[model samples]
Target: MQLPATQAQLSPVAGDASNRRYFRLQLPLRTVIVVDAPPATEKNREFLAVDALLAQSGVRVPEVLAADQERGYLLLEDLGDALLLSRLNGINVDHYYGQALAILRQLAAADTAAVALPEYAAQLLAEELARFPQWFLQRLLGLDLDAGEQAMLAGLDAALIGSALAQPRVLVHRDFHSRNLMCLANDSLAVIDFQDAVLGPVTYDPVSLLRDCYIRWPRARVEQWALGHRDSLHAAGLLPAVDDSTFLHWFDWMGLQRHLKVLGTFARLSLRDGKTAYLADLPLVLEHILEVLQVYAGQDVQLDAFHDWFRQRLQPAIADQSWSGR
Candidate 1:
């Protein structure tokens, strides 16, 4: 923090799906990240507070060297840009994901009570589910639903919200996907963009990683990883004695809720924020949603109705989109 201001060089860096802008500050001996997260729209205070919470719990978040919450600027330790997404492969995925899952264990043990984090409650879950219909179906895809279709969607929402509420609550890194994970030079993984952390479903972060919106692993492998995590959670005393089928049901349904929210989120990012690049990722998210729907088909009347409606009504419209590749 004692370096000459004029001597240091600053350059733009790629940012995440937020209003924040980031820059790299090159000093004589080291580099740091300079973040411009406008306070009006960004959760600067929460970021700072959560950073302290995670750090105290031994989670590797970027060190905050300096901060000005009112002005919305932060100087942070530069965790280099080796995103976990870029490092994944068929051979190395098991090893890398094992490391990531270990971190999730630490996260599960973190003191959510101390931080006063918001609960991922039924209202929040339902609101997120609503985004799919509002932004994706109506706004982006221009699908005008009839009353019956609306009822089907409502039923699906109730089912998803109920499933989420049924899970054990833990410290959730809401966006625990590969891109937010930095594979440091020492081969350890570091978490970022955790300002949205909450006391949420135990399966939420696991599903976020296993069935990532940006990448797809085979169903068998994903299920294996998910169930393995469930065992780890049980060992850590974070989960009760739940069977594989029940745990997988939790994981799959959690993933469905997340993917549906992402569909609308990506659409809103494109239409409202002009970040059209997110549109390219929609097909993978849609695929995740469909796979879950197939898995749970005929098990629940409402879900079955929603699944049928999605394929019969929505698929035709989605197929026409340039990003759909259908």
Candidate 2:
């Protein structure tokens, strides 16, 4: 309840893709993080609400030590600066991803009735998808969708919506990627940036992790992790014994929808919010979309048209960036 003892120092930590600022409080016995969420522009109260929800769900999130709602400040247990993204490499990815998946399994069994969060309904998903055209395509890239491309997008939207609604619904950390996951001292992962949690497709979180924006994995390896997670879900009775092919469809389309949203979000961050750093991450997200699109391109004509449009239009924009390859 009290502030850190005298002589404590505060050092800024790298901020996430948010308006909030975090600083590490260095004290004699321990370190804690302080969140400064200027009341006028940010939603610290919603963050507190979601924190309780995730903690009650058994995920290891930060413990709120002190908070000032009117001042928009909170003292939180420092989960350290070790991000899962920094820890992952060829030698240790499997080990870390295994732990990450274990946390997700725990989340699968959490009590959804206890906390109130919005459902990732079809309309919500469609609205998110619309950002791709409105923000990324028109605003950022200065491109327009032809009538044929628009029709193709309509069909692709129907496919994405159908696949998402068909999957088992569960509590989703919406941004359950490497960056938001912290590496605790005990070696367990702690989740953060979860104010956007939702009741959505079971494949959504898994796809977010494996098809991360800030990082990438081989297609074969990602498929292995994804299908392996599907097996665990089915074995736990969270999902029926859906065939691999069907589950793959759900996973692929879910990642596509998510990446489309991410692309628009990154563009909006740069153009509207004046956060130009996210523009650098756009290439990787585009690569993720292209990877999944190629897999599903042949089966549907409308999808094929959209995929061709992406390859022709979006691919060239990033074809030369240094971090372009996924």
Candidate 3:
């Protein structure tokens, strides 16, 4: 309940997708972050829990300096404003991404048996997939799924869920992307926005990192980085021996499940929450989905059917946007 001091200079920081707002405290000796997460809506306790879990696993997370549980306020160590997103470029992406990827590997292998968190199970993953149709297709685009398309979607959902639950379970930073990673002064990446962390597929975090909604990398480049990560996991003894092709397949499909969920989520954020900036990013996400469908659809009849429907139905909607030429 106690603050860092009686008073301190404060300034607003850029916001994220959550209801929580942040402020930077300019103190005499040290700067810190103050979070205003509404108790009714935001899970401050979950954030605290996950923060501790991440820290224990040697992943850099903002240290909680002060917290008021009833008031939904928290003061945390300042990890600075240098997001890995801003620092990424052709010249520095390798270094920045290497640091960020190492943090992700640490997070995935983090001990979660003692923590009480939701499992990213089949039902949950399917519910996220349904968001695509419910919010994006029906709500945002005012489109309906026909019986055939619905059947295809159902099959696709089953395939996705089966793939997800079949993977080695670990603590997944449900939204592991450049935006949520802070590049520290020491060049290490500090994770934030981790309240939604879950016991889920090992490939989930890497997929978010590689096929990010906010940034696009060449397919070949992404594959090389991903395979290198698998090598890291194997060397660390976190992942069992597996063929490269199989691991890459898991990473690709995991990306599909995530992008499908993101499409619906961004639409809902725009239409319902009036956060229209997210709409600008939907095209990139759509393209990610389309790109993945190209590689995997031939292997599954359901995926092929859904891919055809999306190409014929959804692609046109996105084509109107300047960013989507496909």
Candidate 4:
């Protein structure tokens, strides 16, 4: 049934990375969030699936009260007044992350047998990296990878894929950064934007957390948090007999792949979607790519070339954008 006009007043909550609008609706009896997903781009099935999966795993995502997939509307439980980003301004970062990591551990422990989601396979990873040629090189940079450079990059990408696939796979919350975590009442953390959850390397979400484009942590602090998380996973029986250094390898490599993809994704989100806010953060994402390339310098040569190209092409854009403040 349609909510009576007299019963609720709906206003914009905030826009997201996708083409959906979220509204904070005040009903006579309670407050709820209404997700207004248009039909053209987003399907409602993924949200339903993710909501069920996270709820079953004991993560505190918004509770679904009512949904109309055909109409692209959902009424969700109110998670209340704190996003991790907002809380970061004054509250203790270590304490907030402790709560977030506890939730991540629960997500990683979810039973994969029941919800066998997609994995980040070698082919998919390569295709994602290939966007550097298509979007970053051709469209954004207006340059081409020379023939020998192209072949070398292809080989290097293969090695990176081998390393990525070698890591143990688990449920990854794909975008498990601070912005998506809300601090609810009673010190609880509520997860959001999790429709893209999939099965992937255990390190994928860690990189998303530590190397987040929206907000960054110092390398030492991020590494400490990551090591602590590895221990948390070990204690939970989710990870096998992996040492911290080996796990850090998985974290770094996964970060390289993720940063590469984010570079393209942020560029696309700005140029294609008419959302210019993400353009400001592209430099940090590219820097992350270069940083991880240094970490893998001995294992790969093509990454060095990729790093060089990024420096030549994107560094200019960064400077120009900084000057313009656009």
Candidate 5:
């Protein structure tokens, strides 16, 4: 199959987002992914930035074979079909996690100078969490957070934000999960969807991988994997802190902040982006949130109360929706 130079003749391939199209192309020397991100609705500038940054960091991301920024066309190296999630059956969870951790280490090691990435600052965290009120609570759950409830949430937001800003900062793969990791040839992994990469706590990406909203793993097992990752980062001297337990605290706190952001993102995707597939993953995300809240019990009174209320009201409604819709 000859590769089409223009988007007009490429074969239709499976894609996502109501705004863009993707296609597989075959040339004499290579197979590539052609992304048609129409300028009217979508832009590929971030993708370009991410590709360059990952390549500079020695991570195996799809190479940008060619691009037409004006037309929103990108020809990317075609990483094969086996995703890490698909190969998990009966596999050694420890070893597979080792590979994932290794890849993350490389990404975290990326040059901090590459591009300006967002920090999981107090303002950003609270802004993201506010989506919970707008999308999940008001739109999805259809409930008004009365002044009392709102004040309770305000407290939790303040505490969570303070905890987030106190952690060490590093490169965070905003969506580091199984689906975004490609199982490349020779037992390697290639990272994807890193356009939203940011500078944040080390635990950010690990939580995204182990406690992924799309898939659930036992907390005990996930913890074990996370410890191993922490050790790897420590051994490489990539971390500012030296103590394992201290590192774990950073990870857990960062995770709490991320889960809150994800809950809001998933709800926003469903209500605003018309991407309801993410809604199905809300429970798993909330489970992570509750687990963090429970572990960090003494942090903030308001946070605990909001999480408590979340379990009492939001949990039942989301669970019921999932069951009845099924």
Candidate 6:
């Protein structure tokens, strides 16, 4: 804190898909992360509040060394560059994921009402689902849908939103994926980019992590990990005694809602935001969507119809895209 400005070295760091920018400030004795998150557009106040809440709940997060809320600047303890994504492999995924899941448990115990966290209610869920139609289907894929197709999509959106609202609510790290998790020098995992935390379905964060957009795992293994987490949540008195099928229905449907939103989000990032690198991730996201649609086909009439529409109409278009990897 006492270091002279002239002696400190500031270097730019790669940022996520947001208006916020990050820099590394290398001082004589230590280094810190300097964030330039514009207050008008960024959730600086929410970030500070959630950081305190997570720390108090015993979850690892970057310590706020200093903050200027009006100016939208923060000095955070550097948690190092070892993102959890870089360390995941077949040999150590179970171990690292176990630690990551424990963090989710800690988040589940946090007092959502104390922080007045926004609920992941139906309106917000519906708004997110709408992005798929606006950005992904129309803007990105250049798909033109007739009135019946639009009605079909609307029905599918309602189903997903209903599924999300039916689950037990908990504190959700809205982007609880590998990239947002840091592996500290001590080998403990820390959370980052948690400004969007909300009170949402219990399965939201779990599905965000287990069925990450940037990575994929086999269905059987993913279900095992998901059910194991459900067991832990039940034992902790956070989740009521529900059968495996019901829990998985909650999980898979929650993931469907998320991946659909992600499809639209990624497309928006590419077309509107000019962050085209996100397009490369679309194939995997689509894969996740199709996998769920297939699993639930014939069980839900609307989902089955949507699946048929997607394969018949959208798949051919998607196959022709440069990023489709078909």
Cα miss at 90, model 2 (Å)? Answer: 1.2
Task: Encode model 1's per-residue lDDT on 1-326: one tens digit a residue.
Answer: 65677887999999999999999999888999999999999999899989999999898999999999999999999999899999999999999999999999999988766787898998899889889999999999998888988888888888888888998888998999999999999999999999999999999999999999888999999999998999998988988999998888889889999999999899999999999999999998989988988988789898889888887889999989999987
Show pairs that collide, candidate 6: none
What is the TM-score of candidate 6?
0.98
* Clashing residue pair totals per candidate (backbone < 3 A): 0, 0, 0, 0, 1, 0
Best by lDDT: 6
C-alpha lDDT score of every prediction, in listed order: 0.92, 0.86, 0.88, 0.79, 0.75, 0.93
lDDT of 4 by residue, 167-278 (tens): 8888888889888998877877889988877788888888898888777777788889999999889888988878877888888878887877776776677667877788
lDDT of model number 3: 0.88
Off by over 4 Å in 2: 2-8, 317-326
On a 0 to 100 scale, what is the lDDT of residue 181 in model 4?
90
lDDT of 6 by residue, 16-44 (tens): 99989999999877889999999999999
Considering TM-score, which of the candidate structures 4 and 6 is the better prediction for this target? Answer: 6
**How well does each candidate superpose onto the true structure, as a TM-score?**
0.98, 0.92, 0.94, 0.91, 0.88, 0.98
Ranking by lDDT: 6, 1, 3, 2, 4, 5
Q: Tens digit of lDDT per residue, candidate 3, span 96-211?
A: 88987888788767788778999998889988999999998899887888887788889999998888888888788899999999987877788899999898998899999989
Better of 2 and 3 by lDDT: 3
Against the true structure, what is every candidate's RMSD?
1.1, 2.3, 2.0, 2.4, 3.0, 1.0
* Candidate 6 residue-wise lDDT at 228: 95
Give model 3 RMSD, 1 decimal: 2.0
lDDT of 1 at 23: 97
Instruction: Looking at model 1, report the run of 10 residues with the lowest lDDT sum.
Output: 1-10
* Runs off by more than 4 Å, candidate 6: 1-3
- For model 6, give the 10-residue run with minimal summed lDDT: 1-10
